[model samples]
Target: MGVHLDLSLDADGHHTFQWRRSDEPGALQVAPDTLQRWTAEHEQFRAATARWQQVMAEVDEHLLGDRR
Candidate 1:
């Protein structure tokens, strides 16, 4: 009744995405565009997280310095 999306990284570092459905015997491979979009989104998320972490670290340092 439902489909699930699965992601995997191969030994050579290639990413594979599969869509599995309860009614289907085999999983469907995702399209190249889907993979590319996912990759882009992941990179964007990582960059945003890194920037946020850097900002938080700077804020913490500033607060600690203010306390001293």
Candidate 2:
């Protein structure tokens, strides 16, 4: 995916999301099934990954009871 962003020379730096350029980038599209499968399986989805894991934990706990 081509975004309006860049970086280097600082490995310990943060990454940021940027808007797309005026011209459309073809790389933005992934297979629809792949995207859905990722959302269903992976706990990681960009920077919101932590939130997803937290919610999954809560759901599991609610179903199985708190293990703590």
Candidate 3:
């Protein structure tokens, strides 16, 4: 079983935020109200994530490739 390390809700009353560790106990739960908020917050994070992902992808392909 995986660990339930973190949990958060969005403003739309959805349990959109979540994280699991290598070994955690118990089920994760969130209220509907939290879900709504999480979605809005997630949107902001998405932009940052995209930028980081792009740079990471390039680093993986070039700097950390087997050819290195």
- Among these predictions, the greatest lDDT belongs to 1
lDDT tens digits, residue span 1-68, model 2: 23243333334374433333333554454455655565455334454766876899999989787555
Candidate 3 local accuracy as lDDT? 0.62
List CA RMSD, all candidates: 9.3, 9.2, 11.4
Candidate 2, residue 39: Cα displacement in angstroms equals: 21
The lDDT, on a scale of 0 to 1, for candidate 2 is 0.52
Each prediction's number of clashing residue pairs: 0, 0, 18
Give candidate 1 regions above 4 Å deviation: 1-28
Better of 1 and 2 by lDDT: 1
lDDT of each residue in 1-68, candidate 1, tens digit only: 34457789866586755554544545445565775676688788769967998999999999999999
Model 2 residue 53 distance off true place after TM-score fit, in angstroms: 0.2
Clashes of 2: 0
Candidate 3: lDDT of 25? 40
